[model samples]
Target: MSYQLQDLLYLMQRLRSPEGGCPWDRAQNFASIVPHTLEEVYEVVDAIEREDWGHLKGELGDLFFQVIFYAQLAQEEGRFDFHDILDALVVKLLRRHPHVFPNAELYQSLEAAPPVSMEEVGQLWEAIKHTERAEEAPHQPTRHLADIPTSLPGLTRARKLQKRAAQVGFDWPDPSGVLDKIEEEIQELRAAIASGRQAEIQDEMGDLLFAQVNLCRHLKVDPEQALRSTNRKFERRFDFIEQQVQSAGGDWTRFSLQALDAWWRAAKEQEKKHE
Candidate 1:
């Protein structure tokens, strides 16, 4: 018989049980499992980006297991469990999609619901999210940027911060303005390098990267994905250079810069041919 979500939940419970439980699973806490959850997330992303459909199912299963593990931990602590998680998620989605669920009822017929423009839907989603954020912190002032997680990757976090600020009219008017800001940041970085103070240089470098992320946002590009693509390209070209060196029976130290440059040019040509 095919196993279902209930079976998966049972498996997690067994693994975390004190008696006859997997030692590694039993030892893990919320904080200890965070790294594995992050790795699983990236693996899922990698599989999708590579279009590895055969492995995508397995990667997604691994990511889902991380969620199950977290729920198991919370269940043991007398907190919410997997069912609660599902309930909250479904409720949130129904609440957010007012256009589809006009009566705010999940089981209600959608036949009579009015169609919504994509632009209006986007605005409505943001407005709902802002209201939810305010409700979450009713006693205190609502800081627009307060809810963004600090644990996000630098480029991803920078893009989110920029988007939040833009909602409040605190953003560059156009991509050209962002380009000018990037150029200004680069000049500041150059001056910092000339000063030779480590702290100043580091700060300037951060400013330069933040400006680049802003430029990417203004250009409708994902800075993280763009950098990942470049990284893969670099790896492919370097691998070609290594293969060329091995074919020539030459050591890396013996190869001059000019030889490596020629190999790099050859790699570019090969990539163009494939394209």
Candidate 2:
């Protein structure tokens, strides 16, 4: 396909048109297509992990389709079409990267402009978001860290909320301090449990996880990303175990706990050898 950036919006519209196009595409709405978008995102990550360019190419196309698919649906409903969406983003990109875009203060190299610190970059990004939203609709001036969507998965949202708050000096000074706070929260939870206070226990549990996420954030580690990577590693290791069991003429379900443990050890050893 001879796809160009300027023609992309028109392409998405044609894809969803009822006259002659994809039936699955024609039936989808923004709400109904959300899960597919999310699934495509994971597929992209999987491709990255596997280090397969061909896989990445396919997965990225799938992800790109999700965006276009949503935009097409919006056009069908008389909402802003894909071009409006693209134009808004293009404007935002130019506005945000003042260092790179012409008409802003020039740097020695394009890479060396402003936002010297990570915090400064974050401030600049948020400031642009606030400005854009205000222009779109007034009364959204106060952009709080916890304003992130509640519909996001709790663990993912927790990490994001903690990082957002920390960007504004609302965090422990060091990892050790966060570690100590985690223990304190745990102790408080225990006391709450002893007192039969369900609410207090639930609140303290959140505090504990938030503290841990803060430490992860400060250490330059994304807790959600770390967990997802480990989950992927575990899945690969377990799949290896399954393959090993099958090669030995053994059914995975028929294997005893000891047998599984032995296979797991072998997998670990193989991983270590590769390292």
Candidate 3:
């Protein structure tokens, strides 16, 4: 580590110390820090999406500090510390990227392998991950579905599950097939709604979302990114509607659905014009 990073580590240790440390910093535990860590990750993603490089730098620092916080807590608990985290990452990186790190023991036999495309590199990465998971639980059978973290966002987890199944030739042939399945899922959801059984409806709704995520994967679109873009567009258009309603001397509820629809259309038109 650089001197600056070592200095930061020392600061973290001091802040987490029982004596003369900030009370809030000294009190946090792993579970308590999780929400802040997740928030920092989302903030970093937001900065990147907005193309705000200056804000991104700060967000990245915040995200890195979350790692440091976790490491500090682990050290207090007699678990691994920050250096162990870095060492494990180094090991994993060298083990996974055989094409780049052929001198490593994991890739010594593959040193003569042919040049690989990016797609092949991705396959190699997945294979290495699978091997690592198997090594982690040699007594139990490895299941790709079980390898995906439940903590991931719903859409991301859905995509990963679909991709893992697709690797074993379980996916639809193409986007058209996925679209057909999506329509079928919609019909099932409608049926569940008509049945008026809440549990059935929930199950069908989940299936619909999973099918939609499959369609997104087939179309080469990230469902999370696509939804976020749509969310931003909705917020922008709704803000325009609010402005128009105020100009007309009315509140949102005072405007009829037809009036709101007209405003929405106008907002969309204005957006198109700006584009």
Candidate 4:
């Protein structure tokens, strides 16, 4: 396993070599590789979602290559190398998993203790993370809402931001409260529409969406994943509508709203029949 990984690292180094490396590979900069890295990550997730082990192996290799690409770029700039990255990761893992490490302060008790619930493990993990954060930057100001990446998808970021706030007790007491907030936001959105102010409508729309994220958080659902699942369902249903329209000798653009509605209902009925 170590030999194979070392060979892959050597291959990456050769590809980035200025003398006779692949032109396109050598041309890539950190910024230029971001899109490919993101796409590869999504491909890996897609493989796991589909439970395609063979495809997953390939996708994971692609994802790993993204890490290698970044590490190579950093090495060229005299920042760090692949081993440095691995060292940091290993150090972090050992630091975080005190219960599993022999030299850990609580190792004896953790090893001798009876089985614990996953919730207990999670609380311990969070506590360790808090300690690590404080130790890593002792001079930095303590921040409850530590900087979450703005590059995250809006729904996912909102969930994370809300979760951070919830850690400090700034959240709805229950999912029922979140549902009520959603209803309130809906009314505000309707009023915005009635007022016919574009800015108000946009602001209200944002509020409604934010409320929806809060409800998802309270219900322990990932809003981004939920949205993606709905997107796939819509695609499937729309494809069924298109197939039906074509079977009936019609273009979708030429179909009436009533006709489309009928097709949509039929598609839904087909789904129920399958279920």
Tell me the whole-model lDDT of each prediction, alpha carbons only: 0.93, 0.78, 0.91, 0.86
Ranking by lDDT: 1, 3, 4, 2
Candidate 2 residue-wise lDDT, 1-275, digit = tens: 87686586677767777788778777877789988988899889878877889889989988987877777777777887777988877776778866467554333345545446776777778877766666765745556553578877777788788767766788778889888888898898888889888888888888888777777877888777788889977987898888988897867678888988888888889989999
Give a tens-digit lDDT track for model 1, residues 127-196: 9999999898899998989989999999999999999999899999999998888899889999999999
Model 4 local distance difference test score: 0.86
Worst 10 residues of 3 by lDDT: 103-112
Candidates' TM-scores?
0.97, 0.78, 0.93, 0.91
1-275 in candidate 4: lDDT tens per residue?
Answer: 35588898889999999888999999999999999998998888778866899899889989999998899899999999999999888777777766577464432454565566887777777777777778778999867567678888889889988988887789999999999988999999999999999999999999999999999988889897788778878999999988888898867678889989898899889999999
**lDDT winner, 1 or 4:** 1
Question: lDDT (0-100) at residue 196 of candidate 4?
Answer: 99
Task: For candidate 3, write residues 1-275 as lDDT tens digits.
Answer: 45588888889999987788889999899999999999999999999998999899899999999999999888888999999999888888888877877776543544457779999999999998988889999999898788788999999999999999999899999899988998999999999999999999999999999999999999999999999999999999899889888897866788889989998999999989989
Off by over 4 Å in 1: none
TM-score of the candidate numbered 3? Answer: 0.93
